[model samples]
Target: GAGAETALLLGLPIATLALIVKNIYNGMFIPLLCHKADAYAEVGDTRGIERMHLISGIGLSLTLGIIVTVSYLAGVNMVKGFLDAIPEFIKHGLSVATGIIPALGFAMLARLLINKKVAPYFFLGFVLMAYLKIPVTGIAILGAIVAVVMVNMPKFAASQPAPAQGASHDDEDDF
Candidate 1:
């Protein structure tokens, strides 16, 4: 909903709008179909499961096809104008939520990935991007290099020869 609202607010190109619509349709409808399919599976109805898959596949394809066809026929301007009647506050709220969506996604991902060992590097990348203004590609490359070096460090240490077992260290012997 926020995505669709954002699309309408920004008046994105037809392709982006159509993609957003398709994604929304899948996100809403696919899970519903899956839930029903699960119930059918519990009853051992294999045909129902097959039918559900067929319906979902064809429904999504047709939805995308229809959206593309109708939007092209109607023109983007009409679609853009279609949202003009909505209240300003609702649009503003959706815009704010859309802005926060990326941060929320990153936070969820970090919850899964940010363990003690990984925390320092995660913050390092954040600082590089947020404060140092380095691009993501540069940070990713740096991370890869660091990871390679860290992984091979133990091997490098192991390759070095050990000291002699009974080396004399007396001062008189040295003199």
Candidate 2:
């Protein structure tokens, strides 16, 4: 609950900033970087590439770290005061946007996650958490096991189907 509350509270402006950064990275910086790389390649400058890579990685990491640190410091008191200074209608609009953004994120995830391959795991996790009263630790362990099995050993799936709806006689005491 604390994490959720913190996420909801902090997600609004952070999400906005992230979108801005992503757009800039995709639209501008990426092209510039690519062009620079191509130039280095054209000139047969092998060392340039290594330098560019180092610069790119360090640049982005430092930028993000600074932003995070500064944003966190500002959010400690200044951002709250700044928010308080906004008009009532603007504040109301911000509240609406904050609520809608998470829903939008969920919608996007639902589109990606509710597919055939993933649905069974989702349902299994849901049932484990909701119906079977499994602890978070148990469900996490099971999810990890399932993930490993799915990735490394497709034979497990072909050989034995996890019982329907993840409900089975053997798993009754797993909680």
Candidate 3:
């Protein structure tokens, strides 16, 4: 019981940290990249970013709210039943992990509002960290680099015109 309580306590801070890191990576960095790539113009004013933030925040809250509600209704009893069938340690671990899901959802919503590119990185990083047991910080850094590189590479490729596009009819016939 004491261990479970302690774990729940620890999970709060870890979840908060995870939320903060995810928000910064998605909301700030990815948006900057998108702006640079001309995928979307700068909000033009602080109000615009604020408006986007408000709209996105509300949208995210509504979506997650529904998901959480459904999960509680459909999953709580099922999970309890499953946990009852499992070992005590596993049940404890699952309970602790479940508390972090809300924070993770919030972080995901914040990112989605500001930068859509973050979803893939978040999912991939989450899979790598949770399943593959990769270091979270390292994977986060790697994901950032990969996102930046991938976002910019297409721009670089697009800047180079094909020779065929520049060739005259005579040159085309010669080829």
Which is the leading candidate under TM-score?
A: 1
lDDT of 2 by residue, 1-175 (tens): 5588776666666554554455456567767877898899999998987777777777676766665667666773554555456578955765687689899998899897798888888888889999999998999998999788778787756788566685567866798
lDDT of 3 by residue, 18-74 (tens): 444345456665566445434333534665555556655665556545544554455
User: On a 0 to 100 scale, what is the lDDT of residue 4 in model 1?
Assistant: 83
Flag regions of model 1 displaced more than 4 Å: 1-20, 34-62, 85-93, 159-164, 168-175
For model 3, the superposed segments whose C-alpha errors exceed 4 Å read 1-118, 165-175
Q: 2 or 3, which is superior by TM-score?
A: 2
Candidate no. 3 TM-score: 0.32
RMSD of each: 6.9, 12.5, 16.2
Give the true-structure RMSD of model 2: 12.5
Model 2 — which ten-residue stretch has the worst lDDT? Answer: 14-23
Instruction: Note the Cα lDDT for every prediction shown.
Output: 0.82, 0.72, 0.61
Clashes in predicted model 3 = 0
lDDT of 1 by residue, 1-175 (tens): 5578755644465555565566577779999999999999999999999999999999988987887678767776776665555578966765686789899999999899999999999989999999999999999999999999999999999999998889787889966
Model 2, stretches more than 4 Å misplaced?
Answer: 1-81, 154-175
Which is better, 1 or 2, measured by lDDT? 1
